[model samples]
Target: MDLPPLVEPAATLTDAELRRYARHLTVPEIGCTGQLRLKNARMLCVGAGGLGSPALLYLAAAGVGTLGIADDDVVDSSNLQRQVIHGEAALGTPKTRSAAARIADLNPLVRVVEHRERLTAATAQEVLAGYDLVLDGTDNFGTRYLVSDACELAGVPHVWGSILRFDGQYSVFWGAHGPTYRDLYPVPPAPGTVPNCAEAGVLGVLPGLLGTAMAVEAVKLITGVGTTMLGRVATYDALSARWWEISLVPTPGRPAVTELGVGQDEDPGCAVPCPSSAEDAPTVTAPQLAELLAARERGQTDFELLDVREPYEARLAAIPGARLVPLAQLESGEALAGLDPHRRTVLHCKVGARSERALRLLRAHGHADVAHLEGGILAWIAQVNPAQRPY
Candidate 1:
């Protein structure tokens, strides 16, 4: 869509700003006028993680003037695989601070604002206000809807990008001008229906491809030199190396988003199932599972160790005696064919989330004695068997 420029040109570019953006000046599409617009734009990026890493770096290098980073997480060793904005030395440091430090080195002229807090109903609106545009790089459905609603209420254009494993998707949403995230996802997916990057690992370079595209969308929106992805969703598959597009339109007579969380059902972040205190919802630690397995082997006890993960994961690594019954079969009741409700059973998956879901399913089916492995196979590998490889 050929939308008007989101930002007006700055009064005058400093000598340093002009020299810094000299290459952009050479482009016929993004000349001095477009460069000035970019300098005056205020862009807020939610979740300084995978998708945020490359977007922030490129936006800073393009001199977006002011970039607001909102994230409550810190850098971990796992994030190093894709979050290029943070280095090895930044481990344990807040992501907002780490990203700001990196941006300072990339473009000292651009101002970086660190929100340093999670975006909840109380804070989303306040954080989104005054920004020319917001880039939604959030991971969970909870924060994704929050950013969309907040941006809609504030009437700021939003560029949303998502990456998972070998696939990626991105689009632009502005309720006032076009379809919104709500239009794309009218209702939140059921908890545990979709897995996160941690549960289903991603290629490290995938985010860089999608994140850079997100940055391009932001720049186009700011400068108004190119058509924006306002009403279209672009998808990429790394394995096939193909790009596809899907058109989107606002639902007819969809109620106005007069309130925050209008499209949100619940805030189940990544569908993580934390330990519960209820009597029926029992959980066992990795060490405890190990001991239980040992005691069962010694004929001291009897229990079924059910691996709720997929078959391919079992091929990679699995507990020695666990039986593979994928979570889907359990959820669909197909696993009931050979089921023994009388037998004590323990369930586990890549992480504890799906196993907990499976446990709940069995509990609903009158399984009197059932528990899920806390922290799942990863924890077991860390505690019971360090030799087992992790995906």
Candidate 2:
């Protein structure tokens, strides 16, 4: 269904804007009035990577009046393959700054706001409150849920997109008008069940394709030009060159989001328990784990090194002596029989979130000697083995 335009038309477009957006003004669906609406729209893009890269550039080119970019990460050489907004000169530069510079170069008329900070549960509402619309291109489940909940609470529409390997999915979630992200994914998939783009790898051009689609939806929403993706999800498979749409309905009996940060208990995406305060579960820093491993190798002490990440992740990089027992197998009790109760066990995952969950699960099942590696393999790469490439 077509909704009213998200923003009212501005008084008029400048001569340069009229010429710059001549193609847009030529269209009956998005003529001078719609171009003015685009000029009046304020959009907040959650990440300046991958999907956000293409989406931000296109939105700026489309003449969005104000674009807010929220991202705390810096550009690395690894990001160049997909995050086209940043270049070789941007290496070690903050993603927000890189994206802002690119956007300014693309269209000086569009104002770019840089939010070089991570969006946390505490900051989500405040950060999201000022925008008319949000584009969520965050990679993790926890951030995705946070973005969705914050948008729902703020009554802002969220245009979301995800790309993995060769597949992509994009949708719009507006709690006031239709289904939300939770309506589509009530519970997050089990940790480690889904490999992120970093872990699984993504085609270089995949984000460009999907992120461009997200930009289209945002333009449609702003101008009320065509049917928006409010109640539907579109999936694209690059391998097969196929496109499919699925109708989404609000889940019956789903609790309404009345406040921010109220659903953590029910959200499986909140994988990491507060480390300092979590009872019974202890954490080992990367250095401590290294020392322990050295001691075990020297026969001075003994403990089990359990890697709770997926098989493919282990293949990417792994600790020397850690046994690969993917989190799913441990959660299902299939890997429990192999664990020996006599030895102390240390768990690790990509970072620390999934391993923390594994620690809690082990304790729940009466294994009292398990502790998780504080920062997981990434920490090890950072502190112990600088040669190991981290995902």
Candidate 3:
């Protein structure tokens, strides 16, 4: 399809902007005109965590005029590795506030607006309306769809990104130029089916790589120079140090521009966890787990409680009837096929980390009834069955 005419370029940057962005203005692809556009552009990044960290830093450094942050999470010790925007002093502080303080320090010229509340359906459109573009750095499905739908309604292009372990995905969605996120993932998957970074684990540098790519996309979109990944989705494999691109086309019969509205039916890809897969895995929680164990003891529920923890940890204490299937061995492939997807399955590790990782992998592989013991067996021991031993 033929592309639409590009917007007129913004006027040249000021002397101060030139010096602040000398490195960027020096680049032929992004000269004074681009710097001016960057200075005038307003961007809202949904999450101030991993993906938001680098994305916000680059946008601020590039002189995005107004930056809006929407996040309710506090900066935790665990987030330091990937969320570069937050520092030791900011730990325990709200993520949005922490990020805003950092942005203020990075460039006083860039105005920073902070939304210390979580982004939800009711407030999404209101918060996103004034922005020129939105960068979705959220880790959960609910917020991803919320941001995508709001962007589609506001007609603001969204730079989307996600990372897991060694892999990352980035895409540009919605504009007078191309398709929205609904075109890709029209629905959200079952809750908890998709494990988060805390559960699945991500390489410390992975989000930085993806977030920088998002920053680059935002710059290109705002400047109208070089290639914009409007309809193309880029995938990165950090372990292999390789990148792949796939083109996305608008779904036939999907609404054009005006008919678009925020509705559950609009996002089909939302039905499944992002990084869509052919696999079908189910996830369970701690309460449900204790109930399951109780039912099994009473011969009411018949299923498998596969202990995906290591052998050394298992020696510490194991749940009755829980079979050990150390996570490392499951990576080998054969050990994984031993379980029955059609039956109820519960996975657990020491503190629920590896079990959650196994849950995502199992979901990717087509198992639908798998769940990790909430807080793992540790919680099981603390709450449900006090008689049960935990390590």
Candidate 4:
């Protein structure tokens, strides 16, 4: 099909912009007219992690007029491997601030807004408004629904993408154009059943492939020069290096409109409030955990500390008297059935993220009294035994 002639005005590229965007303008599909639309477009990227890393970099380079980054995390040393937006020097800094600094250095033409907090029902509409587009690069369902609902209410288009291991999924939802996220993912996966990037793991370069596709969709939306990914979802398998597309249509009962916020739970998929809750929703904190372990040491309790780190990590150092259960094998129904749900139990992994997931999984299978060691075994090493080393 012949594409529409992007009617947007030609942007006045400055000497720096002209130099930076000369390549884009030279393309017949983009040229000067498309460049102008890009210059005037505003976009919000949720999460400054794996996907956000490349999405922000490309948006900055594409000269999107304004970019908003929202994240409530800090830069950890481990994040540098895939969260390319941050560097070694930025360790321990707020993610939004770190991403903003990097965007500024990459392209001064793009104005950057930073929100150093998680997106919630209260703040989702407020933060998502005033932007022409939204990008979903978050690693969990809670934030994804928050962004999709906010964008649907605000009448803004969103490009959604997710990466895990060798696989990734992308979709475009513009309620005005077609189905919203609610129409597509009508229900979240049972809470802890789907492990996030932190637990399941993602290849560092995976985001670059998916995020760049998002940037492409955003550019298409602004310039009106080509087919938008709206109503379509894209999936990529890195190992096979192949791409597939899926079509999404609005559910019959839902109507299309431009509102600023949807009532919570009005949509079936948005019913779950938090990502960690679906599987029995068990949780435990540091102080509570400390007391339990102490009781075990004193022979006051009969519970075991289940360490879920991989054998390699467990071999480096492990909690005294703790049993090892590699995280990958955690999905087996019988892997942890040996534990007595009647007794208080503490589950841990290398970092707390995996253990938290494990705790939820245990809770799913009638293990009602399970508790995850907050911050995982790493926290134990820090607070309980400083001299103990970890892999």
TM-score of each: 0.80, 0.82, 0.72, 0.83
Given candidate 2, what's the lDDT at residue 215?
99
Model 3, span 194-242: residue lDDT tens: 6677656799989999999999888888887777788899999998899
Rank by TM-score (best first) = 4, 2, 1, 3
In the predicted model 1, the residue pairs found to clash are none
Better of 2 and 4 by TM-score: 4
TM-score of 4: 0.83
| Backbone clashes, candidate 1 | 0
Tens digits of per-residue lDDT for model 1, 129-211: 88999998988887787788778789899999999999999999999889999899877676566788877779999999999
Stretches > 4 Å off in candidate 4: 1-11, 255-284, 312-321, 327-345, 350-391
Candidate number with the higher lDDT (3 or 4) = 3
- Look at candidate 4 and tell me the lDDT of residue 194: 70
* Top TM-score hit: 4
RMSD from true fold, candidate 2: 4.8
Backbone clashes in model 2: 0
